[model samples]
Target: MKHSGKVPDFQDFVECVEKANSGKINTKVLSIGDLFAWKDCTSKQNLKCRGEVPYARDMVKLTAERGITYLLYSTKYDEPCSKVLNFLQAMLMKNFPLP
Candidate 1:
């Protein structure tokens, strides 16, 4: 499985998740990104952030393909961030209905 810290882009993120869903990753915890770094990167690369939803959908499909359970955990302290996370979670659930 491709390690998380090495994820330079969306493709890498998809690969790591796919590996985990496939049971090829034995690590108990996979560090995908630093929260602060992710926030900063998103701010600087706003255009690239447009792919977030598509990437998320890809992850959902891959996880479902392997019957792997997944969840989006948010630690945002503000109301707006919480709302955004909730919306994203809803969209994911809508796109990938539970069995």
Candidate 2:
């Protein structure tokens, strides 16, 4: 984000969600990337993400801040979103284990 001004990054996602949730309300969550993309993209893309922008981590961090858990991932594709969700969630969970 600092160097790559055009493309988005982790901080960018955080800022995007923060700006989107701009209000006095302390309880709000938003995510442009669903659970599938959130978890999958994190590893696939990581710091070298070079595809469409994502905001799943933004949503995760935002919700986590508010002590929210159990994020349900949805997909608009034909291949069951739950299947993708399972893989993606497992991928992310492996790296970032719950403390």
- TM-score winner: 1
Task: Quantify all predictions' global Cα lDDT against the true fold.
Answer: 0.40, 0.39
Top candidate on lDDT is 1
Report the lDDT tens digits of candidate 2 across residue range 1-99: 354356456666555545553444343344665333432333443323434433465223211222322333333333332312222233545455443
Q: Which ten residues in a row have the lowest lDDT in candidate 2?
A: 60-69
- lDDT of model 1, residue 32: 60
What residue pairs are clashing in model 2? none
Model 2 lDDT, full chain set: 0.39
Q: How would you encode candidate 1's per-residue C-alpha lDDT over 11-88 as one tens digit per residue?
A: 676667767766676543446663333422132243345454433532321212233224243333332211122222
What's model 1's overall lDDT?
Answer: 0.40
lDDT of 2 at 14: 57
Give candidate 1 regions above 4 Å deviation: 1-5, 23-99
